[model samples]
Target: MNDFEFHLDQFMLHCDAKNLSRKTLKSYEQTLRLFQFFLENECKVTEIKDVKSWHIKKYISHLRDRGKYTVTANENTKVYNHPDKRIDLGREISDTTIANYLRNIKVFFNYLFQSGDISENPVKGIPVIKPKRKQKELLDPMEIKRLLSAMDVTKFHEYRLWLGVRLILDTGCRVGELLELKPQDLDLKYNAMLVRNPKNNKQRYVYFSKRMSNDLKRWLKYRDRFSDSEYLFPTIRGTKQNVSNFEKTLKNIGDSVGISVTPHQLRNNFAKYYLLNGGDMASLSRILGHSSIDVTMKAYLDFTDDQIRQKYQRHSPLDNLKL
Candidate 1:
């Protein structure tokens, strides 16, 4: 292999050794490979040492101009079944996606510099690309109630999905973490579940409500009669449910009920409602498994004017006074 390809492989090996999540590793590889391809073809610079800040800037410009799904690192794999292929091709890529690509590229170059493979980091001077924060659409109490009522709980699959929705809403746990849960992970006494496999690779406990606790108990008994899967929520064949499958299932259910829903949306709603109901930022940060309070604040602090007014009314000292 060429020097560039060799260095890329080495970087990936280092990431793998560090036990990075497969999703994270895949993102790194994809971003690096695309950048490598650009370097080789557009800039005609094959050597790792030859890449300059200008080349990196050129790449950023190219990315802004390039349409989505217009190119792939592996041309052969483009024919394979993929979600991106299903979408309309050649649309302008989003700024957020470009920012992610830049972050991944920075990480790769930083690794090389830290490992002493490079004399200087080309990405060191590159300014961090902050993606524009969009307002998160959250489910209202009435909409949530409507979603729950729409589920036909008599059917096993529907009942399982219903409980899954409730669990995420109650605990604010990720769908992936929820799927990884075994019965043993649950602490019924404390109304919490142990999230052994979180996105950041840090384990934390996510608590549910008393109402959720009772529902879980009922579901567990019902689940025992049907499947003996070790996973708390599994497919009909007793296998762990895929995240995409669960998302699609939830989407279809939402479509039927005339509302849009996804697993992440449920988690976001949990955070929003939690804050709306007098929950503090520090505790919310810990509960959401964020690395710091700043991250949590950046995410949930963009409250709309209506939401801010509601919070102000509820927390106003004079309004609560009996005098």
Candidate 2:
């Protein structure tokens, strides 16, 4: 193997040793392989030391020209037969995806530089890709009610599904973290649930409402009847619930209610509603397990005009002072 290939393998081993998730490792592998292909053919650079910042810029331009969803191996060849149907022929991929690829590449080069293998990081010179922010839609109270009503509680999994959605709406937990929840993590009496495996790898407690507390009690009793698994939400075989399956189930519920909803939408709804009801941003940030209040603001601060108007009416200094 070439120097680049050998170094790539070593980096991957290091990543694996660090216990990085399979998904992250796969991304690193794929991005490096694709870049290697580009370097060998387009830039005609056989050695890792020969690569420069300009070559990286050329690669970025090449990616932009290829458009979205269009994967090129060397420089001229385009890949088809991808799994996602929405990926059209030579469509321009979203900035978010391109940003992800760039970010992965940056990480790879940073690792090489940090390990003293590389003299300097070329990726450090490249500016970060800032994609246009998309506003997340919030589910109205009526839509939420209809979604819950759509759940067929008579069925086992559907009953579990109902409880899962309600819990997410109540606690604003990510579906992955929610699925990771164990029975012991639940403190129904205290109206709190503990998230052990959060995205940030930090454990935190998120509270539920009194009404949700009662619902949790009911779910616990019902869950004990069938599932002996450690997970609060387990599949039929009692394994931890899959994220895609849960998303699909949520999509089905959304279809029944004539609204497109997602697990994240439920979390967003919780945060938005919490803020609309005089909740503090700092507390909400902590509750949502955000890295910082700024991160929370960047994501959840995009309230609709009507929502802004309502918040203004309630909190307007003149109105509150009653001059």
Candidate 3:
């Protein structure tokens, strides 16, 4: 090709023709442009096909050195932050953003190398930097209880929306997994549901207590009022729903219930609470569809202490003897 822009345009065309989401295409384009700029200005290179891993590495490093950082948007901007201040305003990109741009850059090269546009895979050895995730903020069971009970279930809206709250607390599924459920995914007899397209496309079964089954039964009947929905929890419209649709409502419920919790908090709480009450990590991992038990353990290292203590209480021989 003539220039980096030419390859980028073709890459974008491929992405669109393959039906990639617009957001995904825009991200690919944005990061490629940054890469192009980096190549021409910093590395004195002009073509993406000619670029090597070292060139890409130096580009990311160059961006970092240039004080690249992304500001986080304030969640409650109208209440706590100035609208103008909410906009990111600096050279500092966030760890996540730096990672994304890097990831997209790698994809660009992989596309080039595989398409015979490049002789060697520049990104073959390049490692994506993973920023240590911030500690998970999880609510305690009582906190969740306070939040759920705080909801006036008699209110029609609250009752209808209760399915979202119940599923999170009971199964510990991600908001995406919870919202992605359909009529076909449920098994009321076994109190199980199949959660598909989880993180990394991992699919797993999540079970609920009998109470959850019963509550779901009630909702399944009334949920049609939301529109004769095929999805276990359909969007306001009959079409497929996005996770954003219900997150705000759940947050509001938590606020009303006197707990500072997100859907994620409830998920962590679900794992933590069950494991606290003699639940096994392996089973919990399966229920949550965690690819590894290590993930569940890391997320709830503190809860494992409780499990250990309970294990001794139940299995220790001395416990049955008179003191």
User: Considering every candidate listed, which one attains the maximal TM-score?
Assistant: 1
Q: Estimate each model's TM-score.
A: 0.95, 0.89, 0.72
CA deviation > 4 Å runs, candidate 2: 41-46, 67-91
Better of 1 and 3 by TM-score: 1
Would you give me the overall lDDT of model 3? 0.74
- Per-residue lDDT tens digits of candidate 3, residues 206-266? 7888998988888877777667777777665666557665677777877775666677777
Q: What would you estimate as the lDDT of candidate 1?
A: 0.88
- Name the lDDT of candidate 2: 0.85
Give the per-residue lDDT of model 2 (tens digit) for 1-323: 99889888999999989887766888788888888888887888867777788888888788888765455433433335352455476777678977888898888889998999889788876999999988888778888899899999988899999999998888899998989999899886787888965344678999999998888788888888888998888987889888989999989878977989899988999899999989999999999998899999998999999999998887899978999
Poorest lDDT segment (10 consecutive residues) of candidate 1: 79-88
Q: Against the correct fold, how does model 1 do in TM-score?
A: 0.95
Task: Report the lDDT tens digits of candidate 1 across residue range 49-136.
Answer: 8888889999999998888887788877766756375675778888898999999988988989999988889998899788888888
In terms of TM-score, which candidate is stronger, 1 or 2? 1
Clash number for model 3? 9
Give the number of the best model, judged by lDDT.
1
Candidate 1: stretches off by over 4 Å: 82-85
